[model samples]
Target chain A: MADAKPETKPKKTHQERMARKKQVIDERIAKATEERGVLILLKGNGKGKSSSAFGTMARCVGHGQKAAVIQFIKGRTETGEFKLFKDHPQIDWHVMGHGFTWETQDKTQDIAAAEKAWAQAEQLLQDDSLDMLVFDEMAYMFKYRYLELEPVLKALQNRPKNQHVIITGRVMPEGLLEIADTISDIRDERHAFRLGVKAQAGIEF
Target chain B: MADAKPETKPKKTHQERMARKKQVIDERIAKATEERGVLILLKGNGKGKSSSAFGTMARCVGHGQKAAVIQFIKGRTETGEFKLFKDHPQIDWHVMGHGFTWETQDKTQDIAAAEKAWAQAEQLLQDDSLDMLVFDEMAYMFKYRYLELEPVLKALQNRPKNQHVIITGRVMPEGLLEIADTISDIRDERHAFRLGVKAQAGIEF
Candidate 1:
């Protein structure tokens, strides 16, 4: 056979190179779906921590996953999240309207509300059927010393292995940090309020 | 005598009236200035959209506002956001990286890089001098197919009405939403090769 001369290879154009890169990326994505056991914490002074949590709840619902939420200090008013998820069959949503201690000032009532909220949280933590749980502003409970960290930690550790959890607040307790698989703190460097502005609907609130 | 009779009124405990109300609803801490225009957008799918946008190089150094960020995308990675802000002099921090993005093709790489860094994000977005801007995954982007929408319309039309702008993407591209805004898209999503599953970092470049 005639010597198979080495054929020169053609160089990939930028577009072609990008396409190849995308294909390879897609392949790797296929492999990442297998891993499990994830926890998330979103803390910050900026807006949207709770919004993000609710967004996750919506995603869980899309996936046909059973999800639950316990609002530690924002139960008083009707939140957009409550309106959206409360009626959804996939989510078990609960809110503790006690608000924050700085605003509430009554230590005794704060403790009582924390106890009541924690009782509901305990049940959610025990339910293996739940694919995800969100503790909205639960950090305030620990920050205010309204709830014992030990029990919360125990509940987190004891929850079903497959269940994922999310906690949102401005203050993150060290104990929660130690237990959290993921922690996000939101820092507010420049906020609109300093300029004497008001919070707009759907943006801040 | 009439004043004495009027004095015999019933006393109310502090908790009774406040019980039905929120101790603290959303409160605006500051306002935006005419010289600055900062707005934040937070909403769906893509990871680090908000983090990356707030990781502006110029603003973090210029302003001394105590900037911060709370990431919704969970998973650890040497985020661009971290390289600039984590140890910087004028920044505060927080993070929640618990391996989100439910549809993963490569589990190991995905989990390893799940924690989206927000160091730089805090430095720039939170600075009082820098003004406030948060890309809390502002939902308008995604709802509009990265091109068009209504929610974003209202956001742009009625933000705190001023200086800083932070936008996170998930398909929001309302009619010239960036009409008077600075806009940057993270562009990269669904990465697997970046983690060396195939594409690897730098080369997946």
Candidate 2:
């Protein structure tokens, strides 16, 4: 917490150690008192970037919170996540991507797709009834400059104070990270693909 | 693919650029043709470690895949995740922790709880009917040495070859990370808790 006591005493016993740690932790817990929808950015090359985004959205359903998602850069019906949340309640799910940029080389087409996705994102940002909004792989759209940064920033800044928005992708746009309330840059010591393990159903996709 | 041509050509047109990138990507995609269940590890001090794990389990429910989970460290029925997956089919869920280490100072009682949880984990490991097995916060048990390493390793080694396992927590055990097929060390540059924002109902739990 903001007023946590500094560890100056020797914690020789387990009881003492716990007491010291608890004193600090309790204060930290007390310091966190705000209750509002947060903007979470899951950015990195690691897996679970989108999975984490989708996972939180899934939690919203069980907790009786309304949520919506606008995926950019890539969308596919074959994905396990898409199949699961396609018809679920409280999920205004939209997979607006054609494919990964590596697969779709046409920049103009990709830009058009991104713009369409952004339109939906803007709409979601404006809707105050929603509780969570996910822009899966929206970073690619920003990184590629398919859409201008001003509108995206404006939407994020002007969205309903109670609506949590999650942006996920490999490269964290420096500007976006600056404004996000929480930024998780997921990384890995090693990757499965590097060692010849292929992406599997219900695991990677 | 294994035999993909390196990008040596200078692409002047968008069509040419797309073709070049697509050729390499197609080959890379072709190279990954194997199908097997993987061991995924989500570990770090950052948020979303458990969210990523539970989210995937939720995905399993909708995708017709059987998934089981054993949550260690802290298990409370009031969690949003518990409310979401309590009645879902194809899920074998078990919450076997009284509380976190800081809350429960009794090592013996904690060990007993971990053993009970491990009993369920061991059972799931041997079942072979499950597609995914999640050891939610199991790393804490391992790090604390509440559960022995030998039996756990043996179970993992002896489990069904195609079964996927997910372990999530901070400070991943060295041994568990070694055997895990995939590892995501989620890191947040700035935690919301540090910023005095409390964990929200749907977002944190």
Candidate 3:
């Protein structure tokens, strides 16, 4: 004999299913929010790596964190970022103040600038009070042999365990990647330069 | 007979002049370093603002500072920055997860997503424990009206006195400028998009 009771199907519409799915996803995200510790390597031929690094400095300052920035091979004149941060009491901003090698053409001067900047960076690296340190265009220093790789590697290794650091420029050394908790390669597929377009104000800069 | 002593003039080379100027500059910079409490605004269209912010985040984490990020209008999928920071136990990396309205044709959905993201950001704004807060692409939100202006103004004003904040994206509102202790407008003289070149991976994104 057939059962007297009829089977009842679950009543869930497509929207309801989606809502449920979203709730589940939200819960997972909330759970994941507790975990944090990241190392980011922004590489590639993109135009904004340095800009991005500065952005972080602004953020840190806003939150009351102490930060230091060492600019290598990019100090030609006063940049907007430099001007803004130069007088800030919270930041320890240092500029090697040497233009690129192509501009300087003096091996001794370039090396001297690199050494001077590296010295400051080393000090910051060892300072436990600094919350963040930026080695702007440091990769280029190693790539161009302006600074020794071994010392940089050693400094990074020996840096205050709690101190954070950022190194930016093209062509990152493999050793950096090996030790980096996070590595990002900024790939270049297309750029405005190939089209002979000048960088626009407030965009390319 | 006139007895005239030969004039003793010290001729200075360009390098020597430069060295003297540098010495003065270094002294001024060193003095500036002693002061604290600097605020900087990294604005403009040039690339690197957000990248710099993330770089700072990495540094903060390395240094053991508590940090957080609130990304607006950049949400589509997981970004490299988000992915890198998501699982870290020390950071609070939150993405609004709604791609820009220009990219998304659905205005209704865009506004909804923006509101959701704003809710999360509001929570961060109210929190006192956050050491650094990076508000990525916030200008776009203000420009697009994805969120209200008054509340944003209020939240920023009410932010923890010592907390650091970074707001990025092009075309900042006048209000933000007035309240910001430091403001940077990134001027782009040219861009790849004008040249009809595609954004290179790692560089553009």
Name the top DockQ candidate.
2
Q: Model 3: per-residue lDDT, tens digit, B1-205? A: 3788766888876566666666775555454322211123456655456766675555445445577888887873334455445677878877775664534556578778778878888888788887668888887777877778888889878877655677777777877776664454544433333333333223344
- TM-score leader: 2
Q: Which docking band does candidate 3 fall into?
A: incorrect
Ranking by TM-score: 2, 1, 3
lDDT of 2 by residue, B90-142 (tens): 77778899887667766788899999999989999988789999898988887
Query: Backbone clashes per model, in order?
Result: 75, 3, 56
Q: RMSD of candidate 3 to the true fold?
A: 15.9
Task: Say which candidate scores most in lDDT.
Answer: 2
TM-score winner, 2 or 3: 2
lDDT by residue (tens digit), candidate 3, A65-147: 67888888877433555654566787887878477564565668888888899888888878988877878888888887878
User: lDDT tens string, model 1, A40-147?
Assistant: 677766555666565555445545678888988875544434653476687787877566655685879888988998999999888988888988888888886778
Position A79, candidate 1: lDDT: 48
* Model 3 residue B107 CA deviation in Å: 3.0
TM-score of chain B of 2: 0.91
- Candidate 1 deviates by what RMSD? 16.9
Docking level for model 1: incorrect
